[model samples]
Target: MTIKNSGKFIIQKEKLIIYLFVLSVVFADILGNGNLNLLYFFGLFLIFKNLKIQVSFLKDMVIFFVPFCLMILGEIFLSGNTFSPVKVLVYSLKILVCISLLSYTKKRFWVVDHLTIIKNICGLFEIMLVISLLTINKPIFWRLNDVINRFSKTRLKFLYSEPSVLGILCGLLVIILLYYIFDNKKNYMLLKEIVLLAVIILLTFSMSGIVYTAIGIIVLFLFQVFKNKEVIPRRMLTYFLLGICLLIIILSTNNPISNRFFSMFLGTDGSYNFRWSAAVNVFRKTMEITRYWGMGLGNMNTPSGLSFLLNIGIDYKFANSFLYFFTENGILGIIYTIYLFLICTYNCIKSSKNIRPLKVGVLAFAFVSQIAGGYYTDPILWIMYGIVCSNEKTVIN
Candidate 1:
């Protein structure tokens, strides 16, 4: 009995650790948001200890590694010092730790229950996040860090490392909100909650978020129209009003919406533009050096500073998260990633069919997240993957 009880305690601790870590990452980008929780350290320690080369997991990770492999090989053969592959491989190892924990704690965290906790956590951050936005104005690029450098010192986003960083966060929040919007029942609170969520997203001034939110809302509105038979409900009208209020609160700043959108495409002028251009040049050079395998892992960051000198380029940053994967990993890696996405999405859609309303709602939420931002970051990726994987587990269990 003692042994059994101990097992349950450990499982609970593990799950709680995961929830804490995810919340940390989500809030990490917020102003003055940096500090390592005990949960992060302990959970990471446990995951690495249990690491094994599982066949299926290895196969999935390896498929993506092929492009990385080429880069690693080039770095090894030519430079000999190999500053390239090693750095990427080392960086990638962090994600492996996250993936392992997600897989390890798969059975521990109760899906719907944990999701409720997540919703609550978001509610908590919403307070701090909105407050942070209220204090800042203009597109200064490093608001979070400025909030930090002047006020506090933390690693996260203090002094926004990049505008895409904000864009990325906004994209993520929008996706999360869309999930709730789809799953929640047709009620005034639900409408208000969604608009409130969108308000939170707009505060970030992330072009990615703004563009993604628009697309996501369109899809969601269609789902509502189709799912409920061609009727325009009064609740939706009210929802729009709430959205307008939220918009005024979040977007009625000095920052022009068009300029913000322009920055996303043009690459935040000056520093961001120059840096991204350099990163893309690295991709171009990699293609020239090893079109077959490319520069691989360590070469993920750039070696070149000029796209004009080595114009294997496009208009935007070469290292945009999705673009980086395709450039570094190549067509094969991109294909496998796409495949995993399709499988999960298909399952979510399939699971929605025979489940209860809430479960169906959760599934819809996952779909919109993928559509708006095909991200592969930790916490966001692993935690979401865990929830998606848990869709198959029984609710009662």
Candidate 2:
């Protein structure tokens, strides 16, 4: 190829890889079962194959790596956990892959139109959700399972491992789609996308998803009110009251969604109870035993306090991400995690006004990551951090 053609080819290849990496992050749950996510592996392979190790990328890696190595090694030697080394190795590899992915995205696509990517992701999610529902009983590639329950029978997982994953992701997607609605004015297409995502979240019967959506909407409304001083706060107040009325209506009904919502508040929802009650206690006891350090990476899989509270023979881990990180990596890990967010917040603040909405979506995702299920190795989480920390010379229009 000519030199000009070769330059065009390289740019095209970069765009293709960027899209593929994003797809891997979004649909990572179905890429493989359990912790062995094929998509994550695929992402690492792509990054390494097209490796361009910049100084900044190395800096980002070291900042996160030093703390991780300290915690894992400390637990292995100081805590004397027999299984700690193997688990630490596995977890470290996953973290390395995610950090590399983050660095590549920040360096390459810093000025790209992220709104287009967000919209495309929402479209793909809608397509997958429809296919999953249509093939609910057929055991197709998109439908993970025909989930049945007392409320919202036949939940749609949409290529993910479970309903809650789909739900929480869709909830986050709604907030992101909303972020693209410039000037707080939702065009027809944006409105439709948000509504569709909200419906998907409802169908999954994910309490965390519902709560995130509610909170996200409130945040956006408040954001608009503050950004446009001419607008009255009554708009936000009206939404709050409307939300209360809707809750009352839903609570009065005899449906699966309502039952799940009611059960959550009553502490009767098994999933909710397991996440907050048992998981919280397990985190607390692990912290006490581990002191300022941690139980070490991958120690949660061992026979810990979770089994006693769960009353199960097998081992379990905390489903809440905040508790999981705290129990495994202790105070230092927690501080590093916070620092990542603070860095994102600071960078986004320094970025152009057009991209500020993304800051809100990122913060909302951060909150959901804590309450919703998933580990620190979650690609979507890292991707958010990457996008927020991208080049400051962003042009969203």
Candidate 3:
């Protein structure tokens, strides 16, 4: 009896720890620098406590960690960046710890329960959004603007460091809310929640978020239409029209949000050109130095800087996520990473019929946003991957 009771206590403790970890991940930006560091330390401790350290886990870790380490080594030896390896190691450790924690939790809990946990995390973000709205007059709640271009218009970032960051978070929540609405047809609350999330994401003015969310909504609508024999359900059509109306109204306004869509793509703006140039420069530099292997991972932004792009005052350090992976880890690193992605995607599709649309939506949102927004360091992306690849069967024992 005592042994059984002790086991239950341990399980409960681990569950609480997992919840804490989720909170930390969702609110990492809002937690402040010092507080966030403390949360990470606590997370590491919980991960250590729950970790079983089996051979399989070790193998998985090596598969994930080796590419990153090789990139760092390349930067050190080939690129002659002595000081960058520490930064790379720190970044890699955070990802490693998150991967380990999610893997451990998935083994003990049902995948549906993991979905619930993620939903709760989204709920917390909504709470934060409410607080941010209330505190908009405060200096801390002010929007972020371009530091180099002082004349550029500011965009709403809320509690995050940038508009795109807030957009990514809200975009994921919108996907989750959409999934809930599809899964529970009678849930009126979810429909309203989706509207609210959609508004928040638009307010962020993140082009990546807007595009990804638009694509996800379209895909979901198509899936429903196909499933129902090409018949568009009245309720779904009504909601779709309502969403379109909201977007039209929002875009008609003379706000920064409206301006972003026009200015981002205009040739005179140079933003699109800048992104292209950044990606090209990174790839060109990587290819110039190494053919099969990469130049190592610490910072791909060469110290001497790329040709005319850097000279023109554009910082080409962070390119698209996939491009960054190729430049940092070379061809093999990207292949291995893509293999992992394909495996996760395959599992998600195989289990789509058994799982809620929320799982599938999360997977879709993560893939699209990561590719478009260059959020290579985001923990939520990896967490979603872990959830999608988890076993479909609910824990019975």
Candidate 4:
């Protein structure tokens, strides 16, 4: 085909890709159902199609791929699954794919483009949160309960069987709500909307959600201080206020630092504690057994298989996600896992510089939430990183 024909075809294809993304976002965000989760295809297409195949993005990608590589090695060295390397590599690749799509889409669109669609859906959720807060049980209403109930009759389910998954989704929602409050500065009318988002976040009873939000808030304060070094007084004043608040929480906890802070609200079942303790136990076992590092890759799979072990870890039946994945996966596991996180973090920072500092700051804060052991399964977490990293350096005149 001629260049003109190819160009026209590409333009049409791009439009379709963007439209698909909007559809997927609505399905996931507003509808609150995972039926559209399959629409990840559209997301993949948008990224791969527009991917900057040049080496310009090589440095950014290297930062991303490093952790992924290390995480795979750790998994292999510890678990030793038949598909250790492949499994680890594929998982890591998925993350990079999302990052690519996110950056590519942002470069091709306006700042507020996707923001508007997402905010609209969030607006609905926010309203539900407000209504629930004012009218229902402890302001904890699952707005999509009816939809979820109906959808559950078949295979479609909004709330997954996985607690961590729920936690991850809740984390994303909290970030979006904050994005409105901090970055967009929604008005008094919208303030209620954002407040509702906060309420919904709390209702999820998700440790990941709560922790990430808290961390994001802390980062936002720092972002302000660093970005506006010239106007340090105001930023520093806010920072000081936050510091005092955080100090109170830290000093008052009863359990171990991580447990007291993270699992208190996960309820008194001791489930959270049990899982975390198991992680420590695994590490302890490794310490006793392995004179050098720990278990090798693919060890966790065992006769039980990798999935079962993960489920066990999730319910706190055996271990927590961090300890189980790292310990059984071993020393390499921890390093690689952290590496993927760092790469994602680096990309977010790079993107922030190219756009409005505030947006970058908001995204950077979101990333910090993840690095601090916020759950990896959260779609919002990935979305936030993808959007921020992809456009880390867009030039808008």
Candidate 5:
């Protein structure tokens, strides 16, 4: 083959690796034991293939890994628990592989060109949603609900183990769809995408998903009105209003989804109260035990700590990511996370002129997920961070 053809082949191979990485992320929980680790191994191999050792990149990796190392040390010295070096090593390796893959992808694919990739990922998620809806009653897929009681009313978990996972995945798509809708006013197809994602999100009965979807739509609308000085076209406005009306009607009715969304705020939801109390107790206990340093990476849900919380009537694991980090990595973890957040925000602001709205929307979704929990270590979050912080020049094709 000619050199040009060889180059094309190499690009195609890299893109295939990226696609596999995305699939691994989406199905990480569903694939069962050791599957995610295998995917990470492949990802690391691909990243190593193109990896150029840079002092700056190595420094960033070291800085990011410090908290994990400190957590391991804390667990050994502070917590009178078994020092599981294997756990620490595995967790650190997974993180390193994720970051390396992200860095490689950012350097290979420009951020402006990422719309196509995002759309493809959304397409895969939509396919998964459809399959989930269809197989909700099938015995083969019932094992996916093992995390939750099978006797209870089922939620649309799809290929995921929990409804909230599906909800968050759908929520990410919703943000992307809204990004396209606002970023390109003439793209009429985005309306249908938005409607479909909204339907999927509602099916999951996740309050966080519902809230973030609304936030994305509102942020996009306001940005268009205020920043771009664009008037809402009458027909488009009519459709938007009608959609909102439908959502309101849905929420007002006495259905599982509506109850799940509203009962949390009304203080009638036992699960919500349990999660809130658990989060509070965990935070309090962690603060008392490890005021500056954390209890340890693996100590967040320690059986003894959990037993203590349960003895006091708080029966649940930590559901809030902020609290989880604070308890696991202590004050230093919070500081590091905040620093990364600020860097991502600053980079998004600096690159606003080139696909600014999309970055802002992505960042908003990630921030909301972090606050609401269940997405602290999501690959999508890191992918967005890599894209936002990447220094690659935008190609305006």
Candidate 6:
């Protein structure tokens, strides 16, 4: 084959790897639930086959893993709480592999025009969501009271574990699409994708998705408004009217989405309240037991103590990522995370101005990860970080 053909083949291969890798993670619930995600493993395997390990990346790993290992060992040896050695091992491996894969993908794909690949993936999910909506009320498509229901009606999860999970995923995609739309001078299709993703998020009735979407919008709007003074007062007025319209909808509509948000503020929403309170309770209990050090890695199980806490009679991790980090790794972990975050933020500030949307998107997702999502091994979080930390001189388009 000619050199041009070889180049085309390589690009196609990269696109394929990215598509499969992202799809596996997105459908991890269906393919592999719990600690053992089949698709996640498969994705990592693909990454390893293609990934070029760098000395700098290895050094960064040491920075992350040393503290992680210390936390795990501390939990096993010092903390008198019930812990699982298998979980510790599995979680550690997953985090290492996930970060490695993300770093590789960022260098190979995100810094290039292969970003069209992500947009294509977003289109694929958008199609699935549209189909699910079209088939609403059908046998399997509309199962009522199955995990996440809104007023006895099935919320659109689209084959993911639950609506919240699906919503979070959609929210991330929406942010990416928004970035694409903002960066590109001519992006009519990107705009449509963001709109569809937003609709899907709303249909899921996930407060997390709604919040993430709002944050993304605000971040992008502010960045654009400051970058270009032309949109100042008109855009501000449009946003004000938009917010008012949203408020009116929430107040007037008696649907599950509206009710859920209302209950959330009133502290009556079970999911919202439990997610927040449980993480806090776990952190508090862990601190009390370990004297604020931590309960160690993969050791989020609440010990038998106060009966008032929202301890569901099962071994579970905290839904909040930051609290989870503190509960597991303590002060050192918090310091490390904060330091990493600052570095990432600084890098983003120094990067190209066109990629500001992605910087904001990553930051928004990071906030949502702490509140509505957790687990150190979450690939999406690492993936966003990788993309944002790509070559500073590279153009995202």
Against the hidden reference, what TM-scores do the models get?
0.62, 0.83, 0.78, 0.61, 0.82, 0.83
Off by over 4 Å in 5: 33-43, 54-63, 66-83, 104-113, 122-133, 139-152, 229-243, 303-315
Candidate 2 lDDT over 58-129, as tens digits, reads: 787776666667666666667654554576677888888777767765765545655567677777877877
Question: Which sections of candidate 1 miss by over 4 Å?
Answer: 1-15, 26-85, 101-112, 123-174, 186-197, 224-255, 262-289, 302-317, 354-379, 385-389
The candidate 3 region of ten consecutive residues with least summed lDDT is 147-156
User: Which residue runs of candidate 2 sit more than 4 Å off their true CA positions?
Assistant: 1-3, 22-27, 108-110, 139-150, 182-187, 228-253, 303-315, 348-354
lDDT of 4 by residue, 132-222 (tens): 4565433133333332112111211123433334445444544444444443333334555445555554445444455655666566555
Q: Cα lDDT of all candidates, in order?
A: 0.48, 0.67, 0.61, 0.49, 0.63, 0.66
How do the residues 355-381 of candidate 5 rate in per-residue lDDT, one tens digit apiece? 566666667777777665663555556
Model 3 spans > 4 angstroms off: 1-11, 30-43, 54-85, 101-127, 144-154, 227-234, 244-255, 268-273, 301-316, 354-359, 395-397
Residue-level lDDT for 342 in candidate 6: 76
Candidate 4 Cα RMSD after full superposition onto the native fold (Å): 7.7
Q: Give the TM-score (vs. native) of candidate 2.
A: 0.83
lDDT of 1 by residue, 1-397 (tens): 9999999998897667666655655544445322232223444665555466555445434533444455445545654333444556655665555565555444444543544554565566566555555555433323444231221221122233434344444444444455455545532344444555555544544444555556555555555545556666666667667667856764555454554444545655443344355555655665565553443443444554223234555444343444455455554456656665665555456654323223233334444444323334434445445445444455451
Residue-level lDDT for 19 in candidate 4: 59
Error of 6 at 114 (Å): 5.1
